[model samples]
Target: MGGFATGLARVTTATILASSALPWPQPWHSAGNAQARGSGRPITSGPNFFTAEEFAMVRQLCERIYPQDEEGPGADGLGVPLFIDGQLSTPYGYGARWYMHGPFVAGPPEAGYQLPYAPRQLYRLALERLNAFCLENWQKPFVQLSEEVQVDLLTWLEKDALSLGPVPGNVFFELLRANTLEGVFSDPIHGGNHLMKSWYLTGFPGARADFMDWINQEGAAYPFGPVSIPVLPHKRDEQG
Candidate 1:
C-alpha cells in the first residue's frame, strides 16, 4: 500500500504539472474558488453531472484507487468526487475544445481521444454498464461489494475483461485513474487537495509566490505548511 500511495503521489504531481499548459473554463475557475473557500463544509449538494447512484459508485471507486492509510486522507476525504463533479459541469466534460465531428474510426493507442463520447457521456455510460456487470456476476452493485471484490472488479476493468458498451473498460479505468489523481493533487482553487493536504503529504510548496530562501537548502526538509490561493469573499459571491 505504501508503494501504491507513493505511485499515486508521483502521478498526482505529474498531473498537476501537465495541466499547467491547458486552458480552463472561466466558470470552472470561479466555481472552484467558491468551493475551495468552503472546504471545511461537508458536501451536501448533489453532483452536477452524476446521478445519486452514479455518484456513489464514483466515490467508492475513487476511494479504492487512492485509499487513506498512514499517509493521509483518501480520495473522498480530499473531495475528489466534488472535483470531478465540478469538472463534468464545465466545457471540458462536454469536449467542447475537441474536434467532436469525426469519422469515428477505430485507431491505435497513439491516436488520442478516438472515442465519440465526451468525458461526461463516457462516465454516464460506463458507470451504468459497470453496475450491471457487477449485478450480473455478484448480485450487487459495484458500490456494495467488499473492498477486495471491488479491487478485483477494478483489475478486471483495467484488463478490459468487463465491457462498458461503446466505451472500453480499460479506457474508462484510465480516465478514472487520471481524474482521481488530478483531484487528489490539483490546486484547491480547482476543488481538490482540500486544505492542501496532498501538498503537505508530498512536501510540495503549493502556489507560493516565492521560496528562494529555501532553494539552497540541499537535502533539508522545508519546514512550512502548503499554501492555497485565497478566495476573496466578494468574488465568491459574484461567482455564486
Candidate 2:
C-alpha cells in the first residue's frame, strides 16, 4: 500500500479499537437530515454549530487528513464535516455525559479527556487560533491555503509544533482525526459513511445482527454488501 493508505489503515484500526470501548448512543435522525446510505447525497443545510467560516476551514482540514486518492473517497466526500456538525449539536458536544467540575490540573495521557472545554468549545477555540496562525504565517485562512500547506499545518498540529491557545494543537488534531474516521465508518444515519463505501473498502459486514454462517469459514472472503441501520424519520419537534 502507498503512504496514504498505510496511514489511513493505522487511523482506522485505532478508531475501531477506541470505538469498541466507548458507549455509543443511538442517533436520532429527522426527515430533513440528508440520508447518505444508498443515495450518497451531500448535506445541503448550513451547520448547526460551526459558522460558515469555521465550517469551511473544518471541511478543508478533514479533506487534508483523509484526502481522496486511488484507494477511495476521502473525508469531504464522506460528508465528515456534516457529521461533525451534527455531533456538535448533540449532548456529546456539550460534554453532558462527562464530569465537568474540576481543579483541571494536567493529568497523565492515560487519564483521558482532562480538558475543561467541551468538544464544541474546543473546535471553536482551536479553529479561531488555527486561522489566526495561518493568516499570520500564510496571509490566508486555512481553507484558502494551498493543499500542500494545509497538510503541513495539520502535520504541525499533530506533532504539537502548533498551539491553539488554551487548547493544545495535538489535542485538537486527535479530536479532528478520530471524528473524521468515525464519520467515514459510522452508519449513514449519523450523517456519514456515504453509500457504505468504507464498509466496502474494509469488507466490514455492517449492522448484520448475525453473520454466524461465515464465522466458521476462516480466511474466507465474505461475499456480501454492507447493511446500514434503518433510518426512521422523526419530526424536528419530536426529536426533543
Candidate 3:
C-alpha cells in the first residue's frame, strides 16, 4: 500500500475536481456548524453512521480518491461514501473482531494493526485533526478548499508530509484509499459499485459461471455484460 502512494499522487488531478453527482457540498453548510457526535445520524435520511459533517467529508474524500473519468462514473456517482458509512455503522467499525489487548508495541510493518483506536475512532479523530489542520493552515475547512489545494493536501497526507496533530496522516490515507477501492469493486449489495460499472470497466465477468469460455481470449472483449446483485444489503451472518 505504501508503495502505491506515488501512483496515487500521480492520479488524483482529475479526482480532486471530479464531482459528477456528489450530494455533499449543498448539505455541508445546511447543518450550520454542527460538530459530529457518536450518535448515528442518517446522511439525508439514509441508513448512515456519520454526522452531516463527517458524511460530507467522507463523500468528498471518496470522490477525490476515485473521481469520474472516461472509463466510468466515480465514487461519488456510485455512492461510495454511503457504503463506507454503512460499514462503519456495523460492528466492524468498533473493531469487534480484533484483539484489543495491551502490551502494545510499534513493531515492524509485519506487526500488523498496532493502533489503539478502532476504525470508527480512527475516522472521527483523524477527520477532526485533519479539519483543524486545514483551518489553521488554509483558513478554511477541507471541504471548501479549491480543487488543486485539495489534491495537494491529500498528497501531503499520502506522503506523511503534514502533521495531522494526533492522528497519523499516512494511516488515515491508507484507510480512506482502501475503503474507496472496496466500495468501487465490491458487490453492489454492499452499497457501492452501483450497476457493477467497475466490472464492465475491468472486463470482470462477475459471478458468471459461463465466463470460462472467454478465459482464453486475452485481447477480445467478453461478449456478455457484467452482472450485479440487488441494492439490498447482504446479511452479515451469511458473509461470515
Q: After superposing candidate 2, which stretches have Cα over 4 Å from the reference?
A: 1-42, 233-240
State which candidate, 2 or 3, has the greater lDDT. Answer: 2
Between prediction 1 and prediction 2, the one with superior lDDT is: 1
Q: What are the per-model numbers of colliding residue pairs?
A: 0, 0, 0
Worst 10 residues of 1 by lDDT: 20-29
Clashing pairs in 3: none
Error (Å) of candidate 1 at residue 12 is: 7.9
Prediction 2 global C-alpha lDDT: 0.74
Q: Could you give candidate 2's per-residue lDDT for residues 1-240 as a string of tens digits?
A: 135434754355545533232221212132322333443324565677899999999888888877766656777777889899999989999999998988798888898888899999999999999999989998888888888778778878889999899999899999998898889878876877776766655656578888888777756666655678765555222322
Lowest lDDT sum, 10 consecutive residues, model 2, at 19-28
lDDT of each: 0.75, 0.74, 0.66
Report how far off residue 55 is in candidate 1 (Å): 0.5
Tens digits of per-residue lDDT for model 1 on 104-162? 98889998888889999999999999999889989998888998888777878889897
lDDT of 3: 0.66
